[model samples]
Target: MSINHDPKALQNPMHVRVAAAFRIVELSDFEARVLSKGYVSREDYDEAYLLYAEKMTAAGFRVEHLLNSQGYYVPNFSSAARDALVAKGDPAEEVAKFESEQWTTIQNCELGTFRLVNAIFHEQSQPSGQFDS
Candidate 1:
């Protein structure tokens, strides 16, 4: 059975650029579309996990990352980051510290960072990165 379309290309490594050098979680379809198209609005970030998953899957994306219902990345840390990474303590406080520290590279303030963190967590969990938590 030969298909005329290249499905994998739709979610190629180029998309990793968004996940690299930052911690991010996959976004809602609304978020993914707006973000992929380079538009950041005051959108409510509304949408459920299933919807986000299905949208990305339909787009031919693997959708490795997942955000909690509250829109928080699970938490990704390395041995190097262990000392700096917030301990498994208060989620709010740790998130605040991370936001204050890496806002620029992470893109926006807390919101952008949280998204990044979640996405990165999902990606890094796949293979490399020898750092330990």
Candidate 2:
């Protein structure tokens, strides 16, 4: 069977959004399938998610500073936006929270997670005394 027959081709809305945002009309079958599922796979999700991050970053919007309380699902920050918020006498606590959250997200993106290696420990120690054998 050809990849064209895959059930998860990018839906209309997703295809439009992705195409507009990424500036590309063509996508590999795997990519279309991945985006259509709304981020089910880690690698695929990261690719799209990072694109969002890159666009926002380029626009001078801090992708991590958006707050849920402020009615933003995705984190976003900009110098202009911050200034406007601060002019309204924004609460210090909320600003701090946003910054903290943004920092955490940045760190996670910068340093990806890894699985720990499994190993066995032996309770063997070399003799401290002179090895006269």
Candidate 3:
């Protein structure tokens, strides 16, 4: 597949679609679509993500490339907590290592549950009656 070297082409819907497809869909589905259409490939996804990271960084956003649980390179938006941890003498690598060591499957499951419950409570507490039709 020929690579588009133009940076403006990164704004093309095809690039966004390809990147979103790879990120959100199952691997098998993405691969099947690529094989059937020949419009985009895994390389396209990587290029699109790279372009996005570059653009975001140029705009002064700190984009940290972190490995997801599936071992894929995912871009994480910078957080103040991460910055504070780094400022306190713990290197980013050390913080990542500590996070990996402490973030177990059970902890992730509990966090998911906590987030869901929090969302439900937040929704319930909203003034829905004010917007009643």
Candidate 4:
């Protein structure tokens, strides 16, 4: 399925809100918001995570959630780290190894929206005269 990628085209307000939040916040902060008290239900968290995974994947990123010892779900946004896991050959074995290392929980989220947000943030962070015309 083709993802719209356009924020304005999103029908769910929560999806739009989550996408907007990701634009200005770091991955940990974003996860914090979702895990905040009374922010959303368990089902809602799953939905929001699905959207996050979709957007990250669209931006050429892999989504891996790590359940830290502090009981917080942290997202691994490092491409090099993900690449290292991929280099392990078998998908099942790689996941097993990764989970055994530090994370108590490891989930692969590869559903489809946030390429536009990533692009906007990337462009804004570029120095003057550094952007390709």
Native-to-model Cα distance after best TM-score fit, residue 117 in candidate 3, in Å = 32
Candidate 1: residue 76 lDDT (0-100): 27
Measured against the true structure, the TM-scores of the candidates, in listed sequence, are: 0.21, 0.30, 0.30, 0.31
Identify the runs in model 4 with alpha carbons over 4 angstroms from their true place.
1-39, 80-133
Give the number of the best model, judged by lDDT.
4
Instruction: Please give, for residues 1-133, the per-residue lDDT of candidate 2 as tens digits.
Output: 3434222244434334434443444544544454454333445444545555665576455656332453222434555555666788889987777667655655444321110000000001222222122
Output the worst ten-in-a-row residue range by lDDT, candidate 2.
115-124
Model 4 lDDT tens row, 1-133:
3334354345544434544644423234333343333234444444555676666555556668665674334566645454667676658777667656423222223222123233323333442433233
What's the count of clashing pairs in each model shown? 12, 2, 0, 4
Between candidates 1 and 2, name the one with more favorable TM-score: 2
* lDDT of model number 4: 0.45
Model 2: lDDT to the true structure: 0.41
Count backbone overlaps in model 2: 2
Where in model 1 is the C-alpha error above 4 Å?
1-12, 28-30, 35-109, 113-133
Worst lDDT 10-window in candidate 4: 104-113
Please list the residue runs of candidate 2 whose C-alpha ends up more than 4 Å from where it truly belongs after superposition: 1-40, 65-133
Angstrom error at residue 1, model 2: 14
Instruction: Give me the displacement of residue 128 in model 4, in angstroms.
Output: 39
